[model samples]
Target: MSSPKILSVDDSRMIHTLINKGFAPYDVQMFFASNGAEGLEAAAKEKPDVILLDVTMPVMDGVECLGKLKADPALKDIPVIMLTAEAGKENVLKIAKMGVRDYIVKPFTEANVIDRVSRLVTLKPKSAAAAPAPAAAAPAAKKARIATDAIKILVVDEHPAIAESIAKAVSKRGWKVVPCAGPAEAQPHIASTVSSEETPDVILVSLAFPGKGALKFYQSVRMNPTLKGIPMVGLSVKTAIFDQNEAKETGYIAIFTKPLELGELPDRIARAMDLDITPIFYSSEGDCQVVSIPQDLSETGSIDLTRQSRKKVADFVNAGFSKLIIDLTGVTKFEIPLIRAVASIIHECNGLDIKWRIVGDDADNLPNLPTVISTNLKVAALKELPNPFTNTAPLDIYPTRAAAAAAF
Candidate 1:
């Protein structure tokens, strides 16, 4: 079978990351464009099997692009999916009138992208592809795993591997994870907990639970007077809009779309359960304060990281540390949210007169972030980001933590 060609026309680099990661297991020929005008040019040339077109973009917006696509008989035949936000009802209605095959909302995961595209094209897993896939597991780092086991989490899913992955990730924060095979086994355990007056702190249930058992479980739990308000977080595929809505209406505390950001899961659980999430990203190295950035940072996660780092930076400065090392070595996705956070932290460091350097690489796009940031000088996301930190520029990014520390 020929590799399916997929074109993404979105300005956000993070969307590219999503597509790349989600489709990593498949043999796909993917193309990307920064805007709609560029998209038209690429679509004309590449002639992909499908196009994932964003609604709002620079140069030409999705609406205009769609109009042009339809106007041109050759391009009009290719299936197009609209990328939009939930709030853009008028535009969605307009695009629907234009006969789009489907639409995906903002803040979506690769699961959403794959689900939609699969409807138009047959997606084959890479395992069944013609060539053998080479895979490697990174060596696990020794982290300060779980200070205490005060919080008990119940993870109910059809797949034990998934439940185990969630367990291993969240267990780092010292939360006790109870994995249940399905609603059948989970109910008995949940019931037993109530008798002991020790019900779980939070429940993570799959929205795609076999036999729609997740909804049944949620409703049963909600209707139970004893466990009426226990926090319940729903895990769902990106395109499960109906399941998500039903989960919301049925009173789910939060809904996290899969593939789950395991790095951010602990923080989300902390917020939902009202647990004190001491920053796991901070450390002391000799006379320097080392800050490690999380790899999977969401918009809200970025805000929280900045807020947490601000307090830590002050504490470290008062402790007589003269240098700050903002580590971005593991970060590959440099979305707008993280950019805002990094800029804010750097700006804060400047105000306190602390010398700081970033630890990252060209591959992760860290070295070029400050350059792009300097362009929009008036944006409040980083008022001081454009200004010179030294005589050179707003940032001094190094290739490694040792190099950054040595330079400072």
Candidate 2:
């Protein structure tokens, strides 16, 4: 009958505050520690049901603390959900090897924290049974709105107001909207729906916090064979070219700015999920082959772009073309993966004794590329294309180029 105790080990006061606010609705008791050492000591005294561990800290880091916790006989069995900013595959594998129950990426919403913790401990307080009877009817009403054959859409956003508005808009079309506060909550929902008849037709994830769990979630889903093909759209408040590019690089089908045009969302979602969407167009000028990338390069589009680039480069080389030009003039924004794809094309051209140049505005510098190849204008890049081959310096100076090019 005692309340379930939960311990949070993090260096950030803001994260601690968010956790408190997130779990306030539940019946659990909360404890906090500023570092891994303090957290280990607190865990021994409190014997909490769950521990939320942060990866990066001033004192002992989360990974070291996790190893120590797992090694301890008394605390080893206690479920630990890691809170981390590092969403890379290598990091996830490392944490998983440490035997943590689960991990949630940072900049998470209240619902995200609660969703992960609830999986490990009883979150509802004993007082939950005393709630008014009328409140129980809400679930039935929600269930009625979702027809068994309806298109299922998953909307993940941290802000309650924004999430609700999206849910309301999508529900009007008779589609079922499964709204989640963050990536942690979204993952479970996505898994549960996979085998069901109403599996999501499209998924909309918020990019409010770029490197936080959103990109990580997208990466995780893509890695899973069952969930990889689903269309995913990114929701954002950012209008900067680089921000949009970052979202695209994560392989979102489309990036829509907030406050969203609810009226157009349904149509966009349909188009994204449509199998008959038009392919990216290619044109030839003189000896150069120019490919124009789509404005919204969704997951499918990204794959197509890569495939088309390879085929085009091969075809152009066979036709005796001397250069390949990726006309990104129409592309205001793009993802990191796209850049890698372009780099791959350039590498292929190099082997074929041909040259390649990317044409785009220089307001935002391309990530993971060296200055030798990048230029502010198409004319400048075209003129300088032959300079690298003329120089005898080792390509080691552009270290990130080959590594980034091979990443995808």
What local distance difference test score does each model get?
Answer: 0.76, 0.67
For model 1, how does the per-residue alpha-carbon lDDT over 1-408 read when each residue is reduced to its tens digit?
679899999875556556766787887899998788999999999999999999888988888898888888889988999898864778678789997889988767778889999999989877655556558765676343222446778889888877888888877667778888888888875773467336776899998876677889988787666677678999999999999998888788889888888877877776666443435667778788877776666565666666666666666554546588888877787666667667777776776567888887655366666665565445775564444334334455788778888896
Winning model by lDDT: 1
Ten contiguous residues minimizing lDDT sum, candidate 2: 396-405
Residue by residue across 51-74, what tens digits does model 2's lDDT show? 999998878999999999999999
Residue pairs with backbone overlap in model 1: 146-174
Candidate 1 whole-model C-alpha lDDT, 0 to 1: 0.76
